[model samples]
Target: EGKKSLNFIEQIIEEDLQKDYKKEDLKFRFPPEPNGYLHIGHASSICLNFGLGERYDAPVNLRFDDTNPTKEEQEYVDAIKRDVEWLGFKWAKECYASDYFQQLYDWAVEMIKNGDAYVDSQTSEEIAEQKGTPTKPGIESPYRNRSVEENLDLFEKMKNGDTPERGHVLRAKIDMTAANMLMRDPVMYRCLHKNHHRTGDNWKIYPMYDWAHGQSDFIEQVSHSFCTLEFLPHRELYNWFIEKVSKPGDFEPKQREFARRNLSHTIVSKRKLLQLVEKGYVDSWDDPRMPTISGLRRRGYTPESIRKFADSIGVGKRENLIDVSHLEFCAREDLNKIAPRVMGVLDPVKLVITNYPEGEEEWLDAENNPEDESAGSRKVPFSRELYIEREDFKESANRKFFRLTLGKEVRLKNAYIIKGEDVVKDDEGKITEIHCTYDPKSKSGSGTEESLRKVKGTLHWVSVKHAIEAEIRLYDRLFTEETPDGVKDKEYLDFVNPESLKIVTGYLEPSLKDSKEQDKVQFQRIGYFCVDRDSTSAKPVFNRTVTLRDSWAK
Candidate 1:
């Protein structure tokens, strides 16, 4: 009851329905340009579109707003499809703006012949200078009044590849002194000799994003065209283009804006992300520490958790910056329910039980996942010799310390109670091993009275003989400062976290030998981890997604 109600977008849709808008008229889309992999921000949009579709029993289309040939790629398109499916959403149809290129070109020709558009031959700089700032009125291009027949012939030649890239641009005829600068004769088409990812070199002219976006939505009969707040000013131009091109009875898609999701501690801009990858600030686009969806997936984020997060944040009209911990909390919450707990000794310290029978070994049953009964249990080998986490042992522990220490008795999880007796060291005096004696009567799960004995310390361990060597990667925040964008004077690279990624060869339970990539597991008393894409059958590598407690860090 204490939580906030549903967001404004939901309210708007509900109100629309109440006012007699048919459910059949509702169609939404998540249109992304196939220029790069989808990021967490895109995840929010996907959930919004698909979630609304499910709620209203409407269909949502997955459209590629790919208009720039220089940046778009087929690889990105494939990856986007994979990501959307992975997030548990199915699109009604997969459409590309390029599919409507011919229709858009015909419409542009119509506009030129009707005196609503013209071709401008001015340089990009000159056009920008004339299209003045938000507060200033813009100056019209010199070619604004070009004769209709001449403009059409030139446009046809431009499409036929007779013109060089940027040699001429088709601009919509609009008021130059409009309050919104975007409406000041916005560029509709441009000549590009480069090959399109989908269209190839079939045509030399392509429509700009503004001209192509609204028309695509109108053609698909979208009822509500949603966009981030940055496009608020461009809404006027988007609607104007629709009114000029749409036939009678065609849906005039309403444009609605919502604030974009901004996290307090990360950078989401593709350009900055690209810089980070190119500069070696991260391993690749899918680096566990990066914000891309693939990166989050590689970092052990579950689709269910991310969807829950998007649902929780909901849709809002005003801007807000969410704390990164909220995302971590959601991920941790989801992993805690499904991840199988296993023993791993990152910093191994040898423990020898002097009182146990020589060369004795036992198979102790450990719960795989306490949260899910269907997960059952697994056998963990316990023997006279075991390896515990180095952090679990202490030569000199404080009064509040609840882990293993000299002269202290602690419970070996799924095993017997053991008391630290002594330590063995090399010539340099650094302790190499700990000597302890197991209490014969304190065998775990045994019916004996001593089996019920309680101890403050409980430690996880691996059988020294059954342990598998593994390379574990520990990741931290990518940037040292919480607000990477806040640093204006110094480059964001200066704040790159030097210790963001740490690699260590550790001893893991042999059960993990065949774990597949992206498989998630929890290291007892450590953290949740996922098998990295870089892992191979010969060497299983894992990335520490996040620790059990937020307080622990290297």
Candidate 2:
């Protein structure tokens, strides 16, 4: 059978193919502005473009639209490349709009010679005022009709570093009264004396994004230029530049816009994210709470999970806000199949096996991943003294409570069944320890009737003597409000969740002592976690990836 039904973009490509568009000519490009790190929203674009390339066996170039030297940096460029590769994509070529600086300058000069563009000496505010609103027609700039020769001289002067910054901007001499505001004399080039990350001080003026993007696509021979819906209005201008620059038989890149993937309870705006980093709202760009690719990776989110999420959401034309829980659900689904099952106690309380030998210890067989039988099993050390979640026990709980309580029987996962008998408290009346007795015949997986006995609750425990102490970071949504950015007259930062991150010491199974950074595992009955980069041999750290169940809604 043929492949699955196509998305709108695929249908467009299919129609083009019927019109004699060669499958081999179906080249695409993913262009990212290197002003900030790549976020989850960008991942969808990456997957779409790269996945198309894979499906058609075509080439997809990774292009950095680093035209605005004021904000673009080499660090951001490197991060973008790293993110793409980490997502299991290989670009046909790594290209940058800055690479076509000379070609873009030459094209601008041609436009000036053709009397289709001119230099305007208007402040940004004046330019904005001239543009007018959607319902109203814009007034023409006073300098719109400058002679081609004069505009040429001024442009050359601007390029030669003689023009003051923002004193004169090269504008395409399009209709001022055009229905689409972007078509009304858009700025094509501007003078900025800043040092470019790639070009350094070689050029004093830079082409605006509208001028650079389409031309770069045309120069690279990209067949399709995919962008978010915000750029839908800019498509006309994108084509206009291609028309002005294209030579005979030169391929014109097609611009298609898709709705941006917006996640609830978080802001994906680079400016706001930067504010969070600069103002110390987060530890860094890789803070687990961040929606950045690096942050997700650091938080134990596997590339498989993110790719699955991108696929599950698919491509759409209408804007929609996806619940963050959906993303967590995907992570849980992927982690369940592969992540090893281990025991961890985030809030530890000592459990003393009163009837067991005090100095004796035994190793019990434990399944690594029940969903993946091939993952087999491992030996977990069990001893008289063990640590369980402090909340798992109480002085007395109702019959509805399945966990440990006085006179209640609970099975220790991979070990024997134990009954809580007594509790020891400190001077503050807080239960410090619980005394219990175990039925040795009830050891898990043993071929005995006692082993088949069922209990209302199964508790995961780590032997206190062999437990590895680890620093655990529990993360939640960065914002309390689901639509923080949608609120009128309110700062998105005002909705920042103060309890987004919580740090606690945890006791882990001994097998995790050798865990390396990025290794993912599921803490039985707790959550999925990833070994953190900050982990060391002496002191390991883990970031809670997601809970065992969806608790946010509850």
Top candidate on lDDT is 2
Residue-level lDDT tens digits of model 1 in 265-363: 678776788788888888788899998888999999999988988888887788787777778888999999999999999999899999877788889
Please write out the lDDT profile of model 2 over residues 1-554, one tens digit for every residue: 79678899999899999996888789999999999899999999999999999989999999999999999999999999999999999999999999999999999899999988999999989999989889999999999999988999999999999989979999999999999999999999899999999999999999988999989999988888889999999999999889998877876889999989999999787777889999999999889899999999999888999999998899999989999999999999999999999999999999999999989999999999989989999999999999999989987888888999999899999999999999999999999899999998998989799999989999999999999999999998899999888998998889999999999999999999999999999999999999999999899999999999998877
Give candidate 2's root-mean-square deviation (CA, Å). Answer: 1.3
Clashes of each: 0, 0
Give the C-alpha miss distance for residue 117 in model 2, angstroms. Answer: 1.0
Q: Which residue pairs show collisions in model 2?
A: none
- What is the Cα-based lDDT of residue 505 in candidate 2? 97
lDDT of each: 0.89, 0.93
RMSD of each: 1.7, 1.3
lDDT score, residue 385, model 1?
88
Best TM-score goes to which candidate?
2
